[model samples]
Target chain A: MQWLNLLNANFRKEYIEMKRYLPNTLALLLTFYIIFLAAFFGIMFVGDPASFEANVQYSIVSVAFWSLTLMTMNFIGFSVVTEAMRGTLEQLYMSPMGVWKIMLTRIVGQFSLQLVMMVILLFAAMLTSGQWLSLNPMTTIPILTLTMISIVGVSFMIAGLAIIVKQIQAFLQIFQFVLMALVFIPLSVAPFLAFAPFVKGVDMVRMVMMENLTLSAIPLADFGFLLINSMIYFILGLFVFHRCEKLAMKKGLLGQY
Target chain B: MEKIIEVRGINKQYVKRKTKEVITAVNDVSFDVHRGEVLGLLGPNGAGKTSTIKMICGLLQADAGSIHINGLDIKKKRLKALKHISAVLEGNRNLYWRLTVRENLEYFAGNRGLSRKDVKEQVEKLLKQFRLKEKENELVNGLSRGMQQKLAIAVALLANTEVILLDEPTLGLDVEISYELREILKMIVKEEKRTIIISSHDMPVVQELCDRTIIINKGTVVVDEKVENLLKLFETRAYSIKLGGTLSVAQEQQLLVKFPLCTYEGSSHETVVNINLEKSEDIYDLFDIFKAEGTVVESIDRTTIDFEQVFMEIVKGEKAYAMA
Candidate 1:
């Protein structure tokens, strides 16, 4: 009963916040439009419909897979961290709900909205003859899950940093830059990214989007290593958020904002 | 009295990150709020009232202390300890700003796991009770400060917990809103059987709404007594004496020297001398001095004291009471 209540409340809270920031959420949606338009225009220039479709497919998948960190990190920063600085953050911590529940619900809200945008972008890409990377549904699912799990860790870490510094804009900008370059740039470098957990899952994503790699392409040992690695980072991120929560309480900034 | 909330020997200190200078915010403070009662956690600005309230509500984990809500240890069983308590912390009302006033109520009600039907029923009841029905659809940002405060407090009532904690419920409110809030508070106490701890600098809020008051200053409890007892004590000790004629310099100087607590307001239009006697017997010494100085006394009245004046007198060191 309690869990259901929490889940329901979280759903309601997320709905209200999403509704409040409709303009921004729509603006985020426009990023998908640009992706489609680029795919459409790029294909048009390619002249051959088949060539344009493949290029559009590769670009959309690459961008969506790559942009997960920037999207989640920024969303958490604005929605959760900024609210925490404003003292309203105490509303959750002081309630019967655990702090993690609040963090997860807000993140899920970000993911849900972003997921919708990704779908739109994919459709637009399809309309323009764009393609997605090749995938052995089996290898792709587990690997993407690991990558997402790792992204969750990164999200938490960024949220914690924002809490400690009580500043989100500067940190969000820096994280977006570092993540785009450090995390995704290496994957964009080549197929070798699958060997490194930091960029491994992204490499798999890029390869699949290019239709160059599939489930049987990777060793089973590689998947295990990536899972363990992402789990560690996720746990560390959660630990830091807990510590940051304590620090905020100590300062009594929980309500002073 | 069955104590609904007992904070035993709580101590809190904050260390600066750079210099590591520890600032003590609460020092060995202890108090109890009986079941179905309102206890005023009173203090001057910068006093430890807010810190104590925070600790009791589990908002700030105490450095060393045990807070028992219905005798359940707060530190050991935090969630269970908190099940009986709800606090309206300063401006943080546990409310969702983007959510409509009704939605905010529903969200918190759902957080408590109340049935949807019950939640809807209660939300509507609360909106009407708070007189927020007309503006229930308005975004919180659009509400006035006083309305926000009222909504925050109304949300607290929805919790239906055994204890309610309010930090400065009347601060920054206009007189009308303050009166309206007090009426709501009074109604809560009379109609609802829930304990309340109100931390505030607003004396009337304390005097009218609280059965007892615990005044903290400089990280320590300075005064803890029943509201009526303290009011009665102050009344017995304070005096307003009218002189038949203007006082001579020697008499005025002696009055100043002898009773440091006295406020001698000498005017040709009205010669009124006010003094807060240090001891009940001190009034006799005052009378003796007046006789010795040959100052004719027109009339003597033990002034009717207000809690604000009493609070100021205590905080200013002119009135001191031993507290635990």
Candidate 2:
């Protein structure tokens, strides 16, 4: 019940801020849409005509996933930096619910809002390219949810670093491309990427969407691997975050920017 | 009285980034705040007052020792210990400037896992109490610094925690707003009966509001005593003497030698000597100097010592006052 209240409050805050910063929000959506258009045009003009449909469909999914993964993974880091700059980070530390719980709820809230925007972008990309991949909500939602666990874990790691460093904007700016590579590259091309945070889940989701596979159709081992990969990253992310928090507290860095 | 906050021999040190030199920010500082007591944590700049406050708030880890809020060790069960305390560590900077007054209140309550519904009445009460109802929907950035500070405090109070740590609650406010904040704080201290630890350079806020004060200088506790007691300690030794005649050169030299801190204002007919004696018996020495001059003593009055004087004397003198 307390967690529920926390979620609701954070969700409300996210919604209000999104609305209040309508221009910035819209600008973000426009940037993603523009990226999707770039991918569509690049495939149309520069790619082979033989695999145009397949390529366009792949690019659409990749673009949407890139935006989602990058935004979700980097959100907490930026949030911490902003809070520290605003001088509210120490105040957040005063929460009995714990700063980690607050950050988790905020990530969940932000992910939900970003998911809506991604859906809009997904449809917008499909509409512009005239190529629609199977969304497969039943198969995709569960896989995506699993994938977010890892992304959230990684976000915690980034947030921890931000807590201590407080000047991670340069690092976060470069991280978007790292997220793009992780999202756009296929697992088949780099099989070892399976061990990376969220890579397994993103590959599974992409395969499900592009191949129109159901949850049961995918091998159970794949699901197991994705689940374990996410849990490990999630736990690792939390561990790193906690360690960073302690370091920040020790150094008295939480309120500094 | 029951102790709500116990800080036991806590120390904090910081390493300079370039020089790599260690600076002790807090040195084995220990104090206990009783339930329903208002404590003024006073210190000069770089005096470890902020470090001590942060350690109690669980925002900073001590290099040594422990702090317990409501009997839960902050280091062991931080979140559990945090249940009993909340703080406005940065005054207005603790608030979400982008958020409205009411939203900031509700949002912070929510951060503590309290629903807006749960804090509805509290939100209303605090808004009204802080005189922020008219600007409830205004963005915090749009509000005055005093208003923002009030909202920040209201947000802390809305947590309904047993202990509230306010670090410089009236640091940059104008005299009018500072006075108003003091009055409001006094009411809260009187009515709420919550343990409050306020750290400020503003002496009146310390003088009028705090039940007890702990003055830290150079990273250690210098004076920890009741406000009235400190005032009285200095008050009894301070005197203002009005003379019917001016002092002779020898008497003046004697007076200067005995009371180096004493000040004298003299003219043709009347002379006045203001002296803060190191001991009550030192007044006799002052009287002796006056007698040697055969200066007719007109009036002698015990000067009232305010908290500011006590603080200056302690900090400037670096006196480690022994409390009874």
Candidate 3:
């Protein structure tokens, strides 16, 4: 019950911020869309129809993966930086819910809003490519949920870095490209890449979308692999984040930016 | 009265990132704040006042020692202990700038486990009490600095914490707004009977509101004494003497050497020396410098001491109080 109330408060706070920055949010989305369109046109003009169709499917998957990363890593990460700059980080630390729980609740709220934006971006990408990847809720929801666990971990890592480092835009920009590669690089080429964060979930997503495999039809071993890796990344992210939080507190840097 | 906050041996150090210089921001500082008492945390710049306040509010973890609020240890039970305290730091940084004034109040109250009905009632009362009813719907960013500060404080009050930590509450405010805030805080301290720990350089705020003060310098406690006592202590030794005649350059230099903090004002024909001596017997030393130049002592008046002068004297290493 207490968690629910905290989550609600966090959601409202983020909602108010989003509404206030609607113009800037829309400009960012439009910029991403234009870039997506340019890439789609380049592929259509260079490739044959059959290959173009395959590339469109990959693009849809890539969009989903990148969208998750952008929302979790960029939004959550930069929000932490902004909070520090505003000097509200200390106020959040003073809250009765504790900073970790407060951050988690804000992540849930911001990620939910990002999910809506993801949907809109996906539709825009589909319309530009003249292809639609049909999503089956039964398979898609569980796969997306599994993928989100790893994304949440990454968000935690970034937020923690924001607290300690104070300035992380340069790091975040480099990470955006790394996340793109994590999505586009085929996991089947090297099986050992399974341990990489979000690789298993992205591979599973591609199989479900490209191979038309239902949730149950996918082998139990593969599902277990994704699940286990998700849990590992989630817990590891928590450990790293808490360590950074402590370091920041020790240096008295949490409220400094 | 019970101690609402017990901060023991709290210490913090910071490393200058670029220069790699280690600085002890707070060093083995310890003090107690009694329930319903207004305790002033007074210090000069870079004196570890903010570091101490932050540790007490659970904003920054101490490298050593412990802070207990309402008898709950902050380190071992952070959330439980923090539930009893709220802080409005120096700037208006504690507020959500994008949210409306009323929304911030409601969110902070609701975040503290208040229900919707209670949050609404409490927020309305705070808006009125802070005289922010007209600007309740305005976003925090759109409000003036003083208004934003008022909202930040109003939000802190909505938490209903027993211990309220105000860091530089009257900082960077116009004279009128500063006076208004002091008045409002005085009323809250009197009526609510809430324990308050104010960290401020504003002397009047401390003199008017705080019952006791702990002065810090160079990350260490210099003096912990009651406000009235400190003022009185300095008042008895402070003097303004009207000289009957001019002093030679030697006498002026002697006065400067004997009393470093003293000020020599008025023309040579009618010079006056205002000085605060450490001891009443030190007056003889002052008179010897005057007598050396054959300067006649006209009259001496006891100068009224304000908290600022007392603070400066203490921070200057002129006096130390044995904390009781």
* The best candidate in terms of DockQ: 2
Q: Looking at the true structure's interface, with contacts defined as alpha carbon pairs within 8 Å between chains A and B, what fraction does model 2 recover?
A: 0.85
What is the TM-score of each predicted model, taking all chains together? 0.85, 0.96, 0.88
Relative to the unseen true structure, what is the Cα RMSD of model 3? Answer: 4.2
TM-score of chain A of each: 0.78, 0.98, 0.93
Candidate 2, superposed: residue stretches over 4 Å from native: B248-263, B284-294, B318-324
Cα error of candidate 1 at position A1, Å: 2.7
Complex DockQ per candidate: 0.41, 0.87, 0.51
Which pairs, if any, clash in model 3? Answer: none
User: For residues B44-155, what per-residue lDDT tens digits would candidate 3 score against the true structure?
Assistant: 9999999898888777889899999999998778889988999998776788888888888877866776655767777888889999999989888899888888888888
Which residues of candidate 1, in runs, are more than 4 Å off?
A32-55, A129-147, A181-230, A251-253, B15-22, B92-94, B112-115, B242-275, B278-298
Q: Put down candidate 1 lDDT per residue, B1-324, tens digits, no spaces.
A: 798888899998987779999999999998888998889988877788878888887777788878898988876666787778877887544566677887777777766666466677778888898899999998887788788899988878888888989999988899999999999898888888689889887788888889888888899988889999989988997789998667778877888899866787776745788988868998888888778867788899999999998898788886667553
Lowest lDDT block of 10, candidate 1 chain B: B90-99
lDDT of 2 by residue, A31-114 (tens): 999998998999899999999998988888888888888888999999999898888899999998988898899999999999
Task: Mark the 10 consecutive residues where model 2 chain B has the least summed lDDT.
Answer: B315-324
How accurate locally is residue A122 in candidate 1, as Cα lDDT from 0 to 100? 59
Worst 10 residues of 2 chain A by lDDT: A201-210
Point out the worst 10-residue segment of candidate 1 chain A by lDDT: A127-136
The lowest-lDDT stretch of 10 consecutive residues in candidate 3 chain B is B315-324
